[model samples]
Target: MSLPLTRLLRKLLHVAAKPMRHAQGKDGYVIHAYRGYGSHSEAFLMGRIFRQPGSRSQLAPGAGRDLMDVGRRMLRWGKSGVEVEVALGDNRTTAITDRDGYFSVHLPLDEPLEHQGQWHTARITACPPKQPPVEGEAQVYLPPISTRLGVISDIDDTVMYTGVANKLKMLYRLFIESAERRTAFPGVAALYQALHEGDDGQQQRPLLYVSRGPWSIYEMLEVFFQHNRIPVGPILFLREWGLTLQRPLPRRSEDHKQALIEKMLGLYDEMQFLLIGDSGQHDPEVYAEVVRRYPGRICAIYIRQIGDSDSRKAELDRLGEELAALGCVMLLSTDSLDMAHHAHANGYIDAASVEMVRAEIEHQLADEPA
Candidate 1:
């Protein structure tokens, strides 16, 4: 299909998915099941089912007002008090969505998934009367047996430059740009790819991306990863954009992130992680805590220094010393090439991959205006 035609079809679907005002309305909701990745002992899958306006509102100026409008629209479309069933690896479970229209199911697997980390299809069907029994498909990834380590990284400034500290520009970058136009930090794609393909150069290490964004933007972020040549993995967003019409949903940030990191640690108990994030947010603090809690479970913590702030430097320095005491190296650098070199030295990636990352950084630098 032509690009215009594809977009037109999506617009039509969005229109058709609008909520009916009546409580017993028959119009169906939309389900967005994110692609999930996990290990042999268990599999994690998550998604959202909304009343389905899908928030097609225009990106007007002013951050606070626009964000409030988006939130209201999502709340308007959330289909609360509904049950969703998930099936994978012959095990099944049912979960009822909260007022926010989000559902998650983590299933245990006694048998091993395929050794090649092949994609497995999982079925998610919304309960009766949310009908015609609307079903959504999700992809579950099982990492290869050659996996040496698992990587958990933050998305905003570490890989893609979303300017999370600047709310308006962040909103503009998210809502207005096409996926291909969204930029990944220079050299990040190459570095992530190297980490994905570990030191032996052929092993496919488990790579996961974690973000604090809402589930509504999951599809757009997947597209961004595709266009930017970043290896996509299970994207675990922190909050549900949907909410009940009668009450307000409190904003959640730091604590929720820490809990999710602990969950990941529990799931992959045998695999150590290489932590990646930027100084613009609470990554230094959150990761320092992870290093303290997990002890030797973290191989290294690489923080991308966002700006020249004495306070930021001091915090990272304090955390770096703390992490070092726990026997994990903490690196604070302004460039992905520095992380690449660290990974290479630590055997996370091979020496040749280090040169590849350096070359990519040089190429990207030359493309920028002097």
Candidate 2:
């Protein structure tokens, strides 16, 4: 569809969704507190207030049910202008939801929090006009002072087989498939778990994910992570598919990812990051640019080889050479095990964890159809 027609349709949909919002408000509003992350003296949390129908129970997956669930998640209406209160460790702050019903809390600590290197709870409440206050808890990850490394990964082809290079197949899998039907890359779960556990197998390094996908698929991605036994991070920075007259299209993926990575670097200035992404898109170029901009902040870059282009390979090799000169190791490999071994060699993960990752890869390969 043309940009103008798409914008018109979205406007109509927004108008139709407004009535459903007030009607559902009879049942009260819900605060969807997404997982957040924090440092010793600062915490950042984000969530949305919505007048949902009621809580949804986990139901058996089927074609019709999956379609309906996707529709429901995508068509949710945000309750705008709602005041949200967030409390963490005796610190309280309030933020009003924007037109999209999203609110963020950036709480600076009066006294530095003692780092236990685990998830902390932040209470969130939203009292919509004349309605009972809805309550939820946001899980905020606080990396321990012992943390030596941080991990940032891409979700599409890096962690899962999303066929992003083929846009039609990518959209089909994204919109039509259930979480159960979605396939994660073999051994990715093990590799990520090891990375999260760190080299000593006791450290609590932070693992943050960045995706170019829309926020509408957040729940589905969570479900996919749980089903695949992947360690759930405190945050998955996703893009908003907003359509306005000033900008009919969403922000460029390269710009969106670069900005988020920069934000992550700034958020945890004490930690260096290991970047993981796939060669199916612009990950190598984007990561290389980040490495250049923030020299020595990135420890390493691992690019999963999903494409078979010799030119692309040469390009990545050149980028790898450039990164090496800046004190970063860039690896372009077709197997997750190779990345795992490299990480182990560089002291990013344990030696035993490399074996575990290898075993998982072998098992997944055996399970593949002949």
Estimate, for each residue in 43-156, the C-alpha lDDT of model 2 and write its tens digit. 899988976553253544444334444355455578999999988877788999988899989988675444464788889989788877888788888888767689999988
In candidate 1, which residue ranges exceed 4 Å CA deviation? 1-27, 51-76, 111-116, 164-167, 171-182, 241-251
lDDT accuracy of residue 251 in candidate 2 = 87
Report residue 328 deviation for candidate 1 (angstroms).
Answer: 1.1
Q: What are the models' TM-scores?
A: 0.79, 0.84
Error of 2 at 357 (Å): 1.0
lDDT (tens digit, per residue) of candidate 1 on 1-370: 8775555445333322322221123234767677776677678887777664333345443443344434444455556677898887566778887666777787777654434445788788887453667777889877765565888888888887874445455544544444334467878888999998888877677777777776555555665677777888655554554455653673465676677778878877777888898888888888888888878888888888877489778877877887787898889998888898889888889998889889877877777655
| Model 2 residue 342 distance off true place after TM-score fit, in angstroms | 0.9
Steric clash pairs (candidate 1): 51-77
Model 2, which residues run further than 4 Å from truth?
Answer: 1-26, 54-76, 111-117, 163-182
Using lDDT as the measure, the top candidate is 2
| TM-score of model 2 (CA atoms) | 0.84
RMSD per candidate (Å) reads 7.2, 6.8
- The global Cα lDDT (0 to 1) of model 1 is 0.71
lDDT of each: 0.71, 0.79
